[model samples]
Target: MRNLHKIKLLYEKYLNRTATHEEVEELFMLLRDRNQFQHIHNIMEDEWERNDIDFSVENLSWEKVRSEWPTEQKISDVREMPIEKHAIWSLKIRKIVAVAAGVLIAGMMLWWWTKTNTKEYRTGFGETMEIVLSDGSRVLLNANSKMTWNTNWQNIQERTVQLEGEAFFEVSHQRMPVNNSSPDQKDSISLMPFQVITSDLSVNVLGTSFNVASRRQKTDVFLKSGEVLLVAKPPLPRSKNDEKKTAGPSLAKHMDSIYLTPGDHITYSGITRALERHEEKLPDEPTSWVDGFLVYENEKLETVLQELKDIYGKSFIMEDSTMLSRQVDLGLPYEDWYTVSELMSLSLEIEMEENNSEITVKKLEK
Candidate 1:
């Protein structure tokens, strides 16, 4: 049997977050000990169900037991009789079991507390949000997106966040530790490294502004200013049956990293794991949908319609590819749904009708 008083004090320290590093290490070691693990687990399970603890607070006391005694030994001394007494020995065992259970319960509660309190932010459909990070960097989250970081974000060893969907980042300039030399070069002062992970690629930046667009199966990254390193990771491996029957080209294992300068864009084609770089002058319109409209430059009607469908969630079915092909130039205004539809109709000489909330484009057929 273990000492109930000592276990209780150690658990108190853990709840307070005042336990020394050594003390935490010892407590976890005790938890894994086969002889004590089960008893500690039971005690903790019972206490959590009986009393709710406010996890956010820095300090907590077991409300039921707090005022009764200062130390577990004091309580035990009062409740226990001489060890020679049969009843006393039995009582001591019971108390030990109860304390063990408490320890187990507290450990589990602490795990849940840490997970639940972590900072998480998400955007819904047709919605977008902008955030100013602790370091004065900025992030603009697109619709149906999520971003998360630790609560102690400013103090963490590394500044990091998990991004899903799409976002644009403007990182703050801060000196970060760097290696003395690259394997291929001599030592020099290198800037702090920042990273953006997507389904298709991982972007490493040293204080720069960029946009990341990652869908479930595709990813696109565009660098607006500063330099970035783009690395493409291989897709997850498939099972034997899946591998044997696969139809397309074999996935590449080595990642291809390309140094991107301003005005460069890299797109990953999901099927091939091949990266295509566009060096042409980027469009003058705002790449970010939140700030301004996207104007197509002499784009085909079909292409313009496809772009609108992506942003506005409205689909257009062209009856005559010939009419769409004949109209070589078209423009679709964003921010106003009706105006975009009207413009499409006037420019293409076609009528648009909404059926079951979906737009269908049809030519006069004359």
Candidate 2:
């Protein structure tokens, strides 16, 4: 019975996206245990019956499921339909049916102790949002960005977040304010460090505010207060059998790291292993997008388009072969898609066609 406590804690960590790599694998193993599977199955079955839901296929064979699923009624019923690309009719139907069946199987296998302790923050294209974390830290997410972390951050070892796209963070400072801990604790553990991680770069801090932009194999971090350490992703260790197939020698000797203080900016290139910095007396330029206006300083045409994507949560395509190195300096409001497209069309002297959320830019005929 004592081992059950460990299982529950590990399962909680897995749900919060805080579990280590090995812990994730172990959690999967635990979920697949026959007794645990039966428990979840029973719980789900009871709920389905209570709701008068049609779950008659719970005992169907895989072959039968493949042949019978994707009924016309089922296809139209799913709320957020998966994007279907052009493919062979047979393959398309099979994929659609598989997606529907997979949802049912996934629902039966799920387990969670508390939904409130884990939260996900996302912004659709053309939308920006702000939310306060469990530790009183505030995060302002730009358009098309996402941030996910456990709400029980204070009880965990460190405050960490998985990040994508761009966001500005304001971290609250406190010393070892452990959530739900006993008042009569004997040993005093120091406050755990905070980390914001992307695929190419990891920013570690104890307490600080910063803005991060991550895209196109590059990560740009602008520190407004406190300090941060940027570490490059290291190569995964090769397996023993693969090493025997034999390469001559190692290519790089050491990893790269950079330290930043207030009013500093660092951009880590994912392609060339180059760490570039701009030491200017920083303006609010890096984060002014929060105020509904975008500021650029001789940025490339492609980079400006990327910034637009961050705000509108949509994509732009170039119809003609234009110089990507074309630079521009402009400040435009990020209110709506059509307005932003009009500003781009006027500033770049191009014709923009907007259909749905996609914008296509074409060169004007003389």
Candidate number with greatest lDDT:
2
Point out the worst 10-residue segment of candidate 2 by lDDT: 242-251
TM-score per candidate? 0.57, 0.58
Candidate 1 residue 358 Cα shift, in angstroms, is 1.4
Cα lDDT tens digits for candidate 2, 1-366: 434445556644543457899986665555543345445444445444554444543664666556655557655554345444323444545443533443344444444422445677888888889888878788899888888776556555568787888899988775774454676764555556888988786788888899998877788899988988776675323345434322335334544455677888877766666666665432778887877788787778887887776667566788864745788887889677778778877887888887887878788776
> What TM-score does candidate 1 get on C-alpha atoms?
0.57
Tens digits of per-residue lDDT, candidate 1, 1-366, equal 565445645665765457898987677655543345456545454444444432221233456334433367755765565656746544444444445445455566556545753567787645678888776678988766788754444333345666777788898875644455576544444555567777676777878888887764667788889888766676523445433323244235555455677777767755577655555433433363646555655556775665565555676776666655553454444355677778767866778998754887887455
- CA lDDT for candidate 1: 0.61
Which portions of model 1 miss their true places by more than 4 Å?
1-118, 149-151, 176-192, 235-254, 279-282, 285-290, 300-303, 321-333, 364-366
Query: What Cα-based lDDT does every candidate model obtain?
Result: 0.61, 0.68
